[model samples]
Target chain A: EAGVAQSPRYKIIEKRQSVAFWCNPISGHATLYWYQQILGQGPKLLIQFQNNGVVDDSQLPKDRFSAERLKGVDSTLKIQPAKLEDSAVYLCASSSRTFGYHQETQYFGPGTRLLVL
Target chain B: SQKIEQNSEALNIQEGKTATLTCNYTNYSPAYLQWYRQDPGRGPVFLLLIRENEKEKRKERLKVTFDTTLKQSLFHITASQPADSATYLCALPTGNNRKLIWGLGTSLAVNP
Candidate 1:
């Protein structure tokens, strides 16, 4: 089976500009997630979706960041009016489910490296 | 607020030695803790997971231990090789939420 797939592995944009990243999860996976990893920091959860419904997005910057999982398979994370701090790697991951002792491991994509000037 | 922390510095060890990494957290009791390995310019790959109820979990040469009372997890890689060089991350599922929060990670370099 194929692993999660992401587009535009690298992106460069100026502050105040907009940028978007796409993700295609593994087949049959019901959960998708977007995370931001600043240099020398861990990936922070930006949003999570389970079958087209948002499971959580408390960390997403409502003012400039938004994400959608259309039809519950693919997801897109967008940032408008990017800031210098937005220059980080955006990672996408998916898992079969989030319940039970066997909490399935999340399969991640290559991630999109964003450099905001 | 919840926070996860891993040693940010890189660890250097002999190829045949054992490598140990620590992850500490506060303000949450996670049901499970997971370990992931990431390379430069790449996303993390899942390595192991240990639940609160379980003391330890092992796979191949990897071992993970979860201590609920101490609010920490320890990951160990035995018989390390240069191929094992990478950043190791620790994650804990957010309380009542379906999200997993990760630590900054510790870089390990097993030299020959």
Candidate 2:
């Protein structure tokens, strides 16, 4: 089976410009997530979706960041007025289990590397 | 606020020696802890998972031990090989599926 897939493996834009990254999760996975991994830091959860509906987005910088998983399949993360500090890898992951499973292990995509100048 | 810390210093070890990395957290009660291996320019690949109720879990040469009281987890790679070199990340779930709090990964270098 194919793993999670992400497009535009990389992106470069000006600080004030807007950029978007795309992710296509593994087939049959019901949970999708977007995470921001700053340099030298662990990934911080930006948002999570369960079948196209948001489940959590507490750490997301709502002022400039937004994401959506429409049709409960592919998803996208957008940043408007990007900041230099936004340069990092944007990872997308999916998990395929429900309430009965002990724990859902997420499968991650290669990630989109964004550089803001 | 919940915080997770891993040894920021890269671990260097001989190819044949055993390698161990540690993950510690504070101010959170995680239901499960996970380990992932990330190579340069690639996303992390799941390695192991240990739940709060479980003390240990092993997969191939990898072993993970979790101590809820200490809010710590240790990852061990026995009879390590140079191919085992990579950054190892530890993560914990906070109340929901896939909403993980991660620790800056521990880089390992197994020299042949």
Candidate 1 on B1-112: residue-level lDDT in tens?
A: 9999898789999999999999999998888899999999999999998988999999999999999999999999999999999999998887565478889899999999
Q: What DockQ results do all the predictions give, each relative to the true complex?
A: 0.75, 0.74
When summed lDDT is taken over every stretch of 10 residues in candidate 1 chain A, the lowest stretch is A96-105
Each model's TM-score, in the order given? 0.95, 0.96
Off by more than 4 A, model 1:
A98-102
Report the lDDT tens digits of candidate 2 across residue range A25-46: 9999988989888877788889
Q: What is the Cα-based lDDT of residue A50 in candidate 1?
A: 86
Q: Which residue segments of model 2 deviate by more than 4 Å? A: B96-98
Which lDDT values do the candidates have, in the order given? 0.92, 0.91
Please state every model's RMSD to the true fold in angstroms.
1.4, 1.3
Model 2, position B18, has a per-residue lDDT of: 90
Q: Model 1, residue B56: what's the lDDT? A: 93
**lDDT at residue B91 of model 1 (Cα atoms):** 88
